[model samples]
Target: MPRRCTRNRRLVLVVLFVAALFVPALANAEPAVWVVKGPHATVYLFGTIHALQKDDPWRSPKIDAAIQQSQTLWLEIPNVDDSASMQPLIMQLGMDQAHPLSTKLTPDQLAKLTRAANSVGLPGGEAMFESFKPWLAALTLSIAPLMQAGYDPSTGVEMELKPEFVKANKPVKGFETAEQQMRYFADMPEKTQIDFLSSELDDFDSAIEKFKQMLAAWSAGDVDALDKLNNADFRDKYPELFQILVVKRNQKFTTQIEDLLKGDSVSFVAIGAGHLVGKDGVPAMLEKQGYKVTRE
Candidate 1:
């Protein structure tokens, strides 16, 4: 089991919420808001957490100002509120009715998964676990603890911002469709998926503590700490998964940012904070393309 699994699960499932209180900019600070200047446009790239606790501090005057100034809101996907549409897609991509999930794991792995599942009060029995792909099962198991801890995806940054954007009559766009995002995991090599599941099951408890640390670092705008927690072990142990999930997506989004920069309008782009840190992160990739990304 790779140590990267839990962090990867956190990156995928959790939405990050930054503190509403703005901290004064300092040297080497990695504020959640980054401003980039194009010849005729200004784009604010905001790193977001996908889910948050109900009481998480997420109101910031600076963030509010950015939202007000922007004409368009870009997210990893649009219509996040439409879970009805997303459910079918997730089912189509993540179900493995052709084979039982038990067949893919060893006895030890199965035992660990069951223990973790029960600990989190996951609703499904073995039948439910057997019906899912390893990646899907892993994701379900990973999120259970967070859910138990009172984090709600519906209360995430995207969900919170979408209605405001709509009420303001701003157009919301997506970098990728829901189906495409689902396939990133669905198309993984079976061995990798199994390894990911096993790793997550093995480290379920520690993963919760690590998630807390991640949230704290994110709230404080500690890019170095966030990068270390999110990317360090994952990059070293699972280069291929890292490439597919983070690097490739960053490349594509960077190209889109360049295109957006060519226009005159201001756009606010929100994506998972995991995609905003490290050498292969969106900010770094944009910098490599000669864009000056400054913390706002």
Candidate 2:
């Protein structure tokens, strides 16, 4: 693939992750929450963002009530507040001592990557990213600009709601471990990783603007717009990644949710919004399985 195409592809992936991290604004429509009714139980599924601005308006009375009513809270991962536990795992999966990342890129790609790193005020420029795997490098670069703009991962919806659930004495659980999630990137084919890095470098300049548009669509609860902006390009251009990161995960989560529905407890499931829309989304998949899924 041309580097430009690769860049656009990787940019879409980052946008999906970042946009999924925070709840959208829901300006003209109801926020994207769903009720899945089974014979024995009910589960509330709320789309979430990983990080967000402090003042972003994402909470509504309906969402608040759902949180309060639920006996169990399920997040993508648990203990998001405990970043310390992830440090060793990140190093194990992300660092490359035998070969620096610079060896894998062309001179021009390396230059672009360096410029991107500097642009985001990441210390050490090219040197800083030298030991990182391409996927990790791209992810770091992708999140840096957003962080610089005051979007905090700590202030993301998941973190904000976690304490509330804890205070209420509700049990919290995770779909995947942080280690498992890291391995998804670490185990990618080298070619794919290179493409990911090149794509991030190519798309770095426009990422902030694209993210803003995505956030707007999310806030508006415009599922069609979110699907088009977040999934369309990725599904078409990077089917493998789309399958691995979104489709397959959604399927696995569906099975877990089915198990949850077999019980009588009311559960609140907060996951990335990206997993809850489009043809292959969780809502559609659940509906196909004969579960009555209604938007709230």
Candidate 3:
């Protein structure tokens, strides 16, 4: 249905989708893949880039054909409403009361967090967000720099695709309700949140650079590049987290995709491009299930 990433890291999803791989560790980039077997419910996997330079090349012709052929547009979460939905959870997720923020982290880490926060124009870290899940905060922090870099969520592809989908009266469906999506945060263990926050806050600039490199790979449909950018180390360190946000969801979405291809629904399935490439990615998963997947 849609693509998701570790935690609520929508920005991370954005990064992975566009910034896929490199030739050294990664093989190469390729174009969009398709599985339009039946005339009824075939799905055209159109990977999406939510943020881009206004001049970034929209180079995939197969993707454009899928978009034109599909009857409706779908997305991960419906809108930014999830941010509002996530506020309470974020507040509750603060440094536990048993170990107040003062004791939870060293002054240096706090300072770093604040400095990172300020770099993106976010209010001071002291601002109440205790209930926030760490992953959610990481996501916010991850996207902050991008905003400063001139990326606007408002200009994201799904945002741009909405008017057309609505005008065509195409049924717009949300894969998960806002609350269900918020629960992804609610259910996370606090330690995971803190660890993620620590890692992200500690490496904000590197993450940005990684994002840049990843975008380069994704532009070429390079699955190999995507895999390297996917970072085996990160996946190993947070296996369950990665499973929940990426692999597990990819598995479920694959089922939905299968059903779509068996019907009359001409679907232009645009997800975070990351889900379509890489090992155990959607294309591979579909292939394993005996479906014929091919470059468009």
Predicted structure with the largest lDDT when compared to the true one: 2
Rank order (by TM-score, best first): 2, 1, 3
lDDT of 1 by residue, 1-296 (tens): 56444433333342122111111122333347889999999999887766666756665777888989999999888867765465566558877788989998899988888788778765554555887888788777666677778776657778878888999899999988877877777899999888778767876888778787777677778888889887787788778877887889899999999999999999999888888888988899999999999988
Q: In order, what is each prediction's RMSD in angstroms?
A: 6.7, 6.4, 6.7
TM-score of 2: 0.90
Q: Clashing residue pairs in candidate 2, if any? A: 7-199, 20-49, 21-49, 21-50, 22-49, 22-50, 24-219, 25-219, 26-219
* lDDT of all predictions: 0.75, 0.78, 0.59
Which stretches of candidate 2 lie above 4 Å from their native place?
1-30
Better candidate by lDDT, 1 or 3: 1
Clashes of each: 7, 9, 30
Question: Whose TM-score is greatest here?
Answer: 2
As for model 2, its CA RMSD to the true structure in angstroms is: 6.4
Q: What lDDT, from 0 to 1, does candidate 1 have?
A: 0.75
Candidate 2 per-residue lDDT, tens place, 1-296, comes to 98645433433334334424333343443567899977879899988887777766788888888988899999988777776566667668877988999999999999898888888776677887788888888787867788778777767788788888899898989887777777777888988878767766887898788788878878777788888877887788778877877898899889999999999999999998888989989999998898989888
Ranking by lDDT: 2, 1, 3
The CA root-mean-square deviation of candidate 3, after full C-alpha superposition on the true structure, stands at: 6.7
Residues 1-114 of candidate 3 have per-residue lDDT tens digits of 243222344433322222222111122334555655664467777666666544444544565667677786666555532344443443454324454443455678677777
